[model samples]
Structures are given as structure tokens and as C-alpha cells.
Target: MIHIEHVSKKYKKADNYSLSDLSLFIDEKEIFGLLGPNGAGKTTLISILCSLIKPTSGSFSIKGLTYKEHKNQLKQLIGIVPQEYALYPSLTAFENLKYFGSMYGLKGKSLDEKIHNSLDHLGLVKFAHKKIDTFSGGMKRRVNLIASILHNPKVLFLDEPTVGVDVQSKNVIIEFLQELNKNGTTIIYTSHHLNEAETFCTRVAIIDHGKLIVKGKPKELINNNPGAHNLEDVFISLTGKALRDHA
Candidate 1:
């Protein structure tokens, strides 16, 4: 479970707030989606939640623990998969994973088994010994995902987990996430893939210009918006067609 209250963020010397008094809650075992175009503040919100950055104002707590008073507990309670590939290109997949696992205080046979099982599950077992620089975009994405979840945190925050991947890789990643959700890991992910979120998310929030626009079940949102037949339709109706170009 997650709780946020009037959270806001403004970059140093920036013209505007990246997140402005945004507030929302994500329930346990729920697959929650944050959908927005470029410059929509999705990543900013996630970064604040992950404690990669502190909020300029207001507060949030995950599973009854605030980052201020319970930083260590919060660290152990969540996993983060950023949009960028957070891997050492020179390291083998297995080696990279082992390093990550150790950060969570895992060791020995247990960590090894976890790494191998995750690699196998994500279709990368054969490439376990292969260097990350040799892997394709999709393979790297899968490896990035495996690295985040090896510690099996109660909540997983993923920023564009499927971006730049082929359809096959996307499917594998989505299915893998669905399985994780089914087994009770709360998932909060940001994505531009409306169709995927339409079916994959239990609830979704569409935000723009650092604020919440709408939030609800995908079907409920679609049905409530007249003439909207799908999530994309509702999204366009709300967010509009202008390009969200930014520096």
C-alpha cells in the first residue's frame, strides 16, 4: 500500500514544478499505471517515491513507512527499475545480478539460485554469462528488470519497463509482471503504452503538467468518457493532441 499527500517537486532554477501538489494512493496487490506523455512528471513522481530525490514539499508513505523516519525499511520494501538501462556494460548478466543481490544483503547459494531462476524466467538463462554490452535492447531490458526484483520487494516501481523492446520482449515482460502481481507484489509503473495499461493495470492515473488529470479503473474511465471506446481514446480526449516537447 502507498499513500501520498499534497506532494510537490520543483527542480532548482527550473521554470515550473515537475510535480505540483500531486496526491494519490496505490493499494496492495494492485497494478497501478501512471500514464502521461513526455514532460508529464511521471518519472518525477516515481523518483520521489523511490527516494532517489526528496520532495520539495509534502509527504508520502509506503506500507505505513515514511522515507524520512524509515529509510532503511522503505529501501527493503520496494524495487525500482528505471527507464534507462542501469547495468554495467562490461559485466556479465550473472555477475551484474550477483552484485545487485549483494546490495540487498543476499549471498551464497540463495542469491545464485535467485539470479538463475529470474534469468531463466525472463528467457536470459543462456546469456547469463554473456556481457551486457553484447545483449540487445530487449535482452538488456529484461536483465534490468531481473536486477530490480531479485530481492522480491513488496512494491515494484517501474518506469517504462517495456520501452524500446520488440513485441515479443514486451509480451514476456508484461506476462512476467502479471505473474508477480498475481502473487501479491504491488506494482506501480509509468508508461506511454496505453493499450498495455488498459488491460494490465487494475487502476490508472493520467497526469499532465505535474498534476493529476484523472484516475480510475481502465474500463471505468473508458465507459465514463462518452464516445471513448478504449483507454487510448479516453487518453486522447483528456490529454489532447499537442506534442509535449521539452528540453
Candidate 2:
């Protein structure tokens, strides 16, 4: 469903590429995980795919729709949930959803029903009438997810969807995503949680310094890498034990 060919990107004033000649193909309805250290270009690759940042060199297309050829069509085909909370703190959950649904030209009873249904599905029904400022971080994240998928996108890109949340909240988010993938939403997500990716992803790619070091099913990678018993073992073996800090 997604094809990335010889995709490379280098930031202005940067001495090296953020992503280097990376080519990836993700299947339809697959939950693909991009795992990496701090400066491994996971975010850069995702941003390029979402068209948030133009690639310095290289190209990609989703479901045969390239940004250069069908920007509007691709926009409608994808949904993005960034790491940050994309919500109005002062607004009620219902109001926030209404504004987001209206952006996709949906309104009235149809939009209202979609909003409430999704909210209920994510365990935010009672909170719908409450102000967002009163919500916990987990609630905000769930609401942020609702905003992105109201249009029912074909491909969803999520960056750290479960970061900074309690175990209970993280479980809810992962479960919701699983349900979405089961319903045929192709999911591409970046995460630092190796254990989460091992079970959640159908396939995963480990990138470092803008290059794909390994890509395969979690079990396959663990078996192939010497002394690796799990995804974390394979990850640390490849990316190393050093800290990846950047300015």
C-alpha cells in the first residue's frame, strides 16, 4: 500500500543526511514499526512520507498516489497523529471533535455520530462533555487520536502514540490501534518501546544514522541476530548501548 524508493533527505546546514537512500514497501493492512535511537531518522522519514517536510532527494508514493501527482487525493488517504497533543485545552472534547470533523467537510448528525462513536470506542464517552483542560495526559492523547481518524483514513501514521502514558492508558491506545488495523487501516508508527513493537507490528525496520540496518518480523530478527533473545536484544546489538543525544 506504501512504496518508498531511494528516499533520502538532508537538512539545511546539516553535515550529513537525516535519511539515506532508504527504500521500503509496507503492505496493505500491515502494522509496520520504525524503530530507532534518538538520531536515527525515524521522525525524518515519517515527516517526509506525510509531506510535512520535503525530501532533499528521493521520492515516495502511497497507494500509487504521489504527492507531486495527487496531493489532494493522498491527503484524503492518510491520517497523522503526532507525538504532541493536538488539542485545544479550553475546549470541550465534543467541541474539539466538531472542529476537526468540519475540516473534512463532515457535520450535522453524521459528524456528531462519528465523533461520539469513536470517543465511546476509545473509552472517552463520559469525558466528551468535559473540558479538555480537566483531562489527564492519556485522555488528551486519546482525544488527539480521535481528531485524526474521524475521516477514516486508509493509511495512518503515528509518532510515539503511547509515549508518556501509564500502562493502563498505553494498553487502551494499543488496543484501539489493533482494532483499526483489523478494520483495514494500514498503520505505520515510530516507537522506542521494543516490547510494544515486537507484538504490535507485523514487520519492523531498525534504522540508525539514516540507514536501515535490519528489517523483518520481530521473531525472525531475534533469531538471526546472535545472542539476541528479543527485539530489545537485537536493537541494542545493532544500535549499541551508547546514548543518542542531540541538540
Candidate 3:
């Protein structure tokens, strides 16, 4: 459902490309994972796809609609759950959802029902009236997810959706995403959690230094690499053990 062709991005005053000639294809309803170390261009690629930033050259299209020509239509087709909490600390959960739902032009009883049902599904029904500032990290993450999917997007892009949550919350989020994929939403996810991506993704691509190194099913990648017993082993084998510390 997504096609990226020779896409590259180099920020102003930067010496090298953040993403260089990256091309990828993701099928409809597939759970695709983009894995890499810090500064590996995963976020750059995602940001370009989300139209939050423009590419320095090359292009991409979502469901055959390019951002330059189909910006509004593409917006309706995709949802983004950013790594950061994109919530208002002052707004109640219900209020926050109501506002986001309206962004997609949903309103009235329909929006209300959607918000309540999502809240219930994500185990946040009891805190619907609670302010976001008062919620824990897990609660905030759940609410952040709810905000993105309220419009029932056909393609979802999530950047580290379970970064700091507890195990229970992570499980719930993964299960919820699996259900969404089952119902026909194409998902593009990026995470450092190799174990989660190994099982969750239908296919994964490992990129580094703004280039594609390998792309395959987790099991296939693991089996193909001699001495690699798991996705983590395969990952470390390809990306290496050096720390990716950045300012």
C-alpha cells in the first residue's frame, strides 16, 4: 500500500544524507517493521512518508496517492502514532479524543461512541475523564494510540509505540495492533525491540547509515545468517555492537 522510490533526505548544513536512495514496498494489511540503530534514517523515512518533512529528492506515494497531489486524501488514509506523547497534558482523555476525532471530520454521537469504545478496548475507560498530566506513561501511550486510530485509518505508521511501557501495556498494545492488521490496516512500525518485531512483523527491513542492508521475514533472516539463533542475534550480526549514543 506504500511505495517509496529512490527517496533521500539531507538536512540543511548536514554533510551527508539522513536517507539515501531508499526504496521499499509495503503490501496492504501487512505489518511491516523498519529496524535500525540510532540515526539510521528510520525516523527520517517515516517523517517523509507522514509529510511532516519533505524529501530533498525522489518521491513516495501511499495507496497510489502522492503527497504533492493528494495531500488531503492521503491524510484520510493514514494514521501516525509518534514516539513522543502527542497529547495535551491539560485535557481530559475524553476531551482529547473528541478533538482528534473531529480532525477527521467525525463528530456527534458517532465520535462519542468511537472514543468510548476505543477507551474501553485499551483499558482506559475508567480514566476517560482524567487529565493527561495525571496519567502514567502506559496510560498516556494507550491514549496516544487511541488518538491516532480514531478515524480508522487504512494505513498506520507507529514509531516506537511501546517504548517505555510495562510488559502488560506492551502486550495490550501489540494485541490491539494485531487485531487492526487482521481487520485490514497496513502497519509500518519502527522499534528497538527486536524480540517484539521478530514476532509481530510480517516482514522487516534493517537499514543503517541511510542504506538498506537486509530485508526479509524475521525467521528467514535468522536462519539465513549462520550462528544467528534469533532476531536479536541476526540484528547484532548485521548492525554490530557499537553504542549509538548521540547528542
lDDT of 3 by residue, 1-247 (tens): 9999999999999999999999999999899999999999999999999999999999999999999999999989999999999999999999999999998999999999999999999999999999999999999999999999999999999999999999999999999999999999999999999999999999999999999999999999999999999999998999999999865
Point out where model 2 deviates above 4 Å. none
Please provide, for model 2 over 1-247, each residue's C-alpha lDDT reduced to its tens digit, 9 standing for 90 to 100. Answer: 9999989999989999999999999999999999999989999999988988899878899999999999889889899999999899999999999998898888999999999899999899988989999999999989999999999999999999999988888999999999999999999999999999999999999999999998999999999998998999999999999999998
What C-alpha lDDT values do all the predictions have? 0.95, 0.94, 0.95
TM-score for each model: 0.98, 0.98, 0.99
TM-score of model 2 vs. true structure:
0.98
In model 1, the clashing pairs are none
Ranking by TM-score: 3, 1, 2
Q: Per-residue lDDT for 16 in model 3?
A: 91
CA shift of 200, model 1, Å: 0.7
Q: Could you give candidate 1's per-residue lDDT for residues 1-247 as a string of tens digits?
A: 9999999999999999999999999899999999988998999999999999999999999999999999999999999999999999999999999999999999999999999999999999999999999999999999999999988999999999999999999999999999999998999988888999999999999999999999999999999999999999999999999988888
Residue 8 local lDDT, model 2: 91
